[model samples]
Target: MSDTATVYRQRASARPRIEAEPPIRHVAVVGGGTAGWMTALLLAHSGYGPRLQVTVLESPQVGIIGVGEGSTSWLRGFFEELGIEESEWMPACHATYKSGIRFDGWSTRPGHESYFHAFASMLDNLTMTQFVDHVHRRLDGEDVHAHPDRYFLATRLAHACKAPRPRHEFPFDVWYGYHFDSVLLGAFLQRKAVERGIRHLPRHVVAVDRNERGDIASLQLEGGETLAADFFVDCTGFAGLLIDKTLQTPYVSYADALFNDAAVAMPTPLDGPIMSQTISTALRHGWAWTIPLTRRHGNGYVYSTAFCTPEQAETELRTQLGLLDADVPAKHLRMRTGRVEQHWHRNCLAVGLAQGFIEPLEATALMLVQRTASLFVDALEKGDLGAAAQATFNTAVNAQFDGTRDYIVAHYKTNTRTDTDYWRANAANTRLSEPLTRLLKTWLARRPIVGGIQQGTFGQGYPVMSWYSLLAGMGLFPDDGELRAPAAHEPPHSLAAIDNLIQRSALNFPDHRELLGAIPPRPREESLQVYFW
Candidate 1:
């Protein structure tokens, strides 16, 4: 080891084999909505499965801000990992079947008390000790919804309208999710990423260039077409064209812990069929949401332009949704939650609403845009990305958008409704983040259940039957009665496998228009749909 350390280890072993990342053959995906063709159809079904060449610029006068519609149950494994076929995209997106979301009158303000949080994953090990002993005998006074009561199967399939059936092993039978029509799920994933070939440019990026070691080397459309790429995803929504406008990078603003910041949206049409679930309610300054979508029934409200006054929150959201056009024309928006501290800055990567946002209630804006394009194709198929695997994939997609913005700010700091002035001003303009104020004091003292998958968002939050159905449907049930004894710590004898998984989920639940008459529809712009398989 002499002579300049043997020529610096022979010029670092003849340096020259980065190929600058592989498989992502010429991808672009600036913004097509639904997180730009769901990250260009999962990077064209992984590593450009069909001769890699995705495109999707989009912006024919920019639009797609179709707020969330609702989803979970890992969007049925992201439509079978993109081969797609939930009967060809849930009836062209009129979709319906979400067995969750009721949240009515969010505690205190006219609260008639509620709790079910179902999407089936009814904790195993003697069905979460007999569904916490039927929610501690419905808080010691029985009536878990009366009559030989059983609690949680999303509370007996919400009075038996049922819906999720086909199962072989999804944590174990019928745990569903889907509401659909957020602009027909971005036009049914932009027509199945153009019949699985993908390529569209519509235009309107205006400028993106970058390269002095800054990375994102192309895209400047607006008629002067110039789209180049090795990689770049920035679903351009909150105008962050390539991780905050050509990499100026720097976002992180849960406005001191979420302040509602205004919203409006509309659609209204429901009369029948479309209502598998999704409601929200709770008003006086914020929180509305409805959502049915098989055609229409959206509604939104979201409040707080510093506490009401968007003409008094659209006149209290058209006097609690009677709506004669709930103050007519809609989709107002104002946002200011936060994220993008670095959803991969250099070679560009900022998915959906340009990486970070909270306040869709739940339905996690296309599940963090298919979990940031399936964790950036599992860190580019372990090929090697360095900068510590891009800071561990931008700290695991910024801890899944800051652990779902602290579970949507623990649904407004455990709101017991301070009656108005936006529930009498709380959530102190976003100051909670000390690990979500110590996981909301062990999630409001139930002690331990701080998101398992072993904490810190990567198994993407919500589970424990979606925080046992939104902190026991916002009544926040758990002052430590040790969940009032389900045979005080175990065995009630195989607890009849929760009554044989509720009589095999009642002869395998059906009727959501008979599972859309058993899957089939693959059309778009609406019409011809099915998928009960």
Candidate 2:
């Protein structure tokens, strides 16, 4: 791992620049939809639209390839940070608070399945000392599920349909996220960007022009008109018109790390607006996801081409869910699991599907668009807009992709189901990331540092409370060896402390049903509703 301090020094020395000077004056964003609009939004929101001309070249033909919305904690926070109002979002996107994902039937022998919810919150939490004591007590023949049941609050609240309250109202209650329609979220972002004075031209990119230095200098539209810019952002989706096609940057395939390449999405209706939560279940050929949006449920099967064909996969989906709407079409999208070696090459940076993508297990794909744009703006702030800064930016973007790739891979790798071809394929896959391999070894030794793909992804912005949920609730506990709290820690808090908070806080909140009743009829997910106890 590179030292943070050293990386900073090397970065500054690599790109010497004028202080507070904007290296990129006129920026051209290629493509549209969520990624393009997101990039434009951030640029405009950061006060770049006024000083640097920001033009989003969108093609009505190149529609966004997104199913419903399943996003991370960052997604909501990003909107909140941007000061976008709740009503501006909720009504348009079938937006609702998402505590976490519920995975059903990934374990057990053929056909039989059980499930657990991977919440942003946790069950009861005991300090290290208390946890060790509980473990010891368990070893001595006592059941500790009761203690952990109290410790992890999310488990009970999910069943009860209660949202976590502010810290003063509960014990260890903090951090939350959302589940909104992807298409609507994209529209919301586009509207905000335009409101901030961003220029959006609905034009399809026909060709990419490069200067002698191999940097993208202009974009040729379908009408034989050329648009020029000092810096270009390739939000062009998979075509990569500006980033790869013009710059000739090579892409590294992550198919080996992330096996599932294709997904079939179907929109199924429920009786009322859907509740907030995405259910990702492990299927035989691949994993299937059921997301309950406000008006309809978004269902998808993501599987590897090696295991099944599109036609076969579609058949399986239909058999599982019965026929989707006869009038509306069910779409099947194909993709490779990986990204460009350089997300930012030369003056061109590729965002969204163009940069790369893994399967959308946790909705990291959407956040990637926002994160990439925000990070580049950070780089720009560092006055490292020269060639060196660009290279470093590319390297850092790849790191983020690789990190996310491994994180998603962990979900499949840490599982122990091997009943069907799909499970077998995911299980037999021996390749794992270096960090994951180390974590797995630690977990095997019962030292439990952080194991599998999805372990410990939340950083300072995200705390231990979040990671601990997926760790314990999903049955991916670290081994007994690592269960001991770090040397100087105190005993964990009592489960009673956690549960009592929920019990008390539940009284103040409106019935989940009541809240839904007050809202307008949502656009989708008519059948499902979720409440926290």
Candidate 3:
């Protein structure tokens, strides 16, 4: 046998085996939408015995907060774990592949007005070292090409309007996610969970009954039916029916750091070929997200009501979409931008908006939900839902939320726009977390960010490359006139070489529109009027 194969076998055999029975046999997930259905699906698929029953309590009267949503690469892993093929769910969800997000006009620096934050791929390993080197050199006032868009393959693919899927001959895998109808996705997951033997209870939670220990005990339905379970998962969006309303978990608001609390969303017709990336353009009061699905474009303006009225935000969005006089309806949403003190409090766990939300700039809503559900499953299996386990889970999950918040906060903090009061306020905001403050200081000092990022607890939310991309993309360095030629001993970077490599790598991926065309199309469903969750 090969030496590598022998080592792999030895390591695989050395791992400890788990044999304990699950502590909780019944898990009730309240509030059905993407969050509830997803949690239910994860629990149903968890290798727990058939004795463990998973139930989703969905209210029929509640409308879905359906928008064209984008996801991070985590969704790809979710589908892989469930053995659900892209061909199966993508068509059903009116989904299109997303390579990454393209930020437009977030910065006003010349040549840095826009940048693409591409999802990392296996191919990045070959070029990331040099990219980091160039970023450092540029920070040192050396003339160099360090734009993030130049080194990443996903950026090239997105620019070319190509899907992330490589040809059969290509050996490297490109990580990617999707843009889909949120409502359709929830429905799709509901179907999958039901098929996996998860029970679906469509009833409104009229009241939450708590045990003497302050943990959730049972839920009273509107129809006078009472449903009890060992553990409860709250996917009740902003209502926090189980976690907040019943358990009274202390909610921490991010309003001081993240100013955008209100959003106006509406759909627009697809005017041309589908693009493979979400576009986030800095608007007057806040930012606008343009997400392309198969049938239409999902456009929304997420702004602070403190700065502009909902009507003004909607008008701006309508003007941007050229629908100012058009009859299409717009959905206005109010967001409570913060997380609860404890995600897994006692017997109840909060997921989705019930847990908390950072803005959708990076399409992290579903990503956070998926992470929480996955972690809860692992904790349940290994720790048997013990107090120590719950504490540990809460600590880790809270850190994750904070870490994601720091990254999103950095976007506003580093923005160079001065066009509006919103931009000026974000620029001058001092309500940053200590971790973010330190990271910014380190970057401003032109020190190695990887070391600080490595030592920090909150930095794990985003990779080291992402920090580099954001800082470098925003042109957060010395003036161009101050740049000097590199020293003789300093190794040179070849922009042409990186460009050639990206162009060549992109050739393997098919056109985004053509790739969607190849997927078997499901019959289009009528648009459902819904509120933003």
Best by lDDT: 3
Task: Assess every candidate by TM-score.
Answer: 0.32, 0.81, 0.93
Q: Which stretches of candidate 3 lie over 4 Å from their true place?
A: 1-19, 519-533
Per-residue lDDT of 31-101 in model 2, one digit per residue for the tens?
77888887887776553326767999889786778787687756654664455555567668876656566
- The per-model lDDT (C-alpha) reads 0.65, 0.63, 0.85
Ranking by TM-score: 3, 2, 1
Residue 38 miss distance in model 3 (angstroms): 0.5
Give each prediction's root-mean-square deviation over alpha carbons: 23.2, 7.7, 6.3
Q: Name the lDDT value of residue 169 in candidate 1.
A: 31
Model 2 stretches astray by more than 4 angstroms: 1-19, 47-49, 109-143, 146-150, 162-174, 272-274, 324-328, 450-468, 474-497, 511-513, 516-533
Compared with the true structure, model 3 gives a TM-score of 0.93
Please write out the lDDT profile of model 1 over residues 181-296, one tens digit for every residue.
77777888898788777888787888777778878788878767788888888788887767876777988788767788778876766675545677787788778888776556
lDDT computed for candidate 2: 0.63
Better of 1 and 3 by lDDT: 3
Task: For residue 136, give model 2's deviation from the true position in Å.
Answer: 9.5
lDDT of 1 at 293: 66
lDDT of 3: 0.85
